[model samples]
Target: MAYLRWVLGRLTAAALTMTGVSVLIFAAVRAMPGRYSDLVLGPLATTADKAEAARRFGLGGSLPEQYGHWLLNAVQGDFGISMASRTPVSAEFAARLPVTLTLTGLALALTVLVGIPLGVYTGTRGKGGGRTGRLLGSLGLSVPEFVLGSLVVFLFTRYSLGLTVGEYVPWSQDPVRSALSLLLPACVLAVFCVAAVARTTRDAVLGVLVEPHIAAAVARGASVAFIVRHHVLRNASIPVLTLTATLSAYLLGGAVIVERLFNAPGLGSFLVDGLDRRDYAVVQTGVLLAAAVFITTNLLIDLVCGLVDPRISALAGKARS
Candidate 1:
């Protein structure tokens, strides 16, 4: 019952967060300098033409009214038509979202797999792996995603390791090629996240290590592995989980940058295209979906952290009481 209550509270918070995000995105979209009307009708279009275009595109009402209308339709799965492509935004995103998700998922998996172990090693007083992890983490943190991407492009182009140029194969038809294609871009996307995750994990572990319980475990002759598995990980999880949530948000932006750099057919490039064209439907849908995704990911991570330590659920129960 406590677990149920905890989940319900998280769900409620997520819903409110999504509502606030929708409002911000709506206002920002409307505030951008130009509109679908300006793009579709051209400069020669008169004020009447522009107003009619706005009306046709469902941009006709006051800010609150427009938001209400958009939200209503969006809830029903009617995510407006694209000003640039003249297609339903949902349909367009449906095809591209998986690509971005897959790429980002790969990047995140690599990050966690590499980061946590390195952090554990360092925090546990391992000398060699810890030194290498710290040095690489520092360099990774210092480099920008675009710069890493450009470096990959230059190196690959100059070296020509037999891979096709400008090829982006989808995983549906050919998983191997798709994985190969996504590898470099995924590395670029993961670079900063890996460093950040490693640093955060190391700090969390180190913080837990100084606690009295950790000392008790050590004094009790617990193996390093046993102590880490039983004490350090569980105690350090909240911070690591929080960092993962933040990293997911960072990954969304990095995905967009790397997709453009690699010319990958993902929502990042799709969203960028919409921005370049000033396509209200496309950009709004993209931002709102990304926000929804980020919120949902955080909720799941919170659930995991809560599960790892039921005291967290107890805290939620206390709040309700």
Candidate 2:
């Protein structure tokens, strides 16, 4: 019953947040200096053509009515037609979503696998390990994704490594080749994720070490491994969970530049192409889908945190009450 209540509360909150985001996006996009027609028709288009294009895109109606129509169409999974490509926004997303998902998934997996263990080691070992951690973290955080991606491409694709450059094989067609193609880009994307997560985890673990219970365990001659494995890690994990969730949300939209650099068929590339052409339907749908991914990721993270530490769910329940 508690779990069910928690789920319901989260769902309600997520719905409200998503609605607010949609409204803000709608208003912001509409408030941009030019009309949707201006983007689609270009500067040389006559006034009459601009008017006709606006009407076709439903920009002819009052803002509220236009928003309502668009929202209704969206609810029915019709993202309307892209003014630039004349393709359905839903179809565009459908085609590119898998690529983004695959890349992000690989990057995230690498981040967790590499970051957490290294953080734990640094926190537990303190002196030498901590110094090493700081150096690596600084290097990772200082490098931008674009620079990192370029370097990787140069080294792996153009240099002696002789890896194929910017060629993606669909996983369903050839999973090995697809994964191989993704390795450089995924590593570039994962660098920042790993750095941020490692720093957060290290701080959280260090904080946990000073707790009374942890001191008691130390005084009682508990093994370092035992204390770290059982008490310290458990308590420290809460913040790490939140950080991971936030990073995942960031990765969904933040991959645009990286995707473009790699020429990967991801949602970020789709969004960029749409923006370049002033494809209203594509832009709206892609942004909304990214927002949805962020919201969903956050909710799932909250649920996982609640499972890990019942105090989180208790706090949430109290807030609702």
Winning candidate number (lDDT): 1
What is the C-alpha RMSD, rounded to one decimal, of candidate 2?
2.1
lDDT of 1: 0.85
Tens-digit lDDT string for candidate 2 (276-302) = 776767878888888898899889988
Runs in model 1 deviating more than 4 A are: 1-3, 46-52, 126-133, 162-165, 319-321
Score candidate 1 by TM-score against the native. 0.92
Worst 10 residues of 2 by lDDT: 29-38
lDDT of each: 0.85, 0.84
What is the C-alpha lDDT profile of model 1 across 113-143, one tens digit per residue?
9888877777778567567668978998999
True lDDT of residue 45, candidate 2: 95
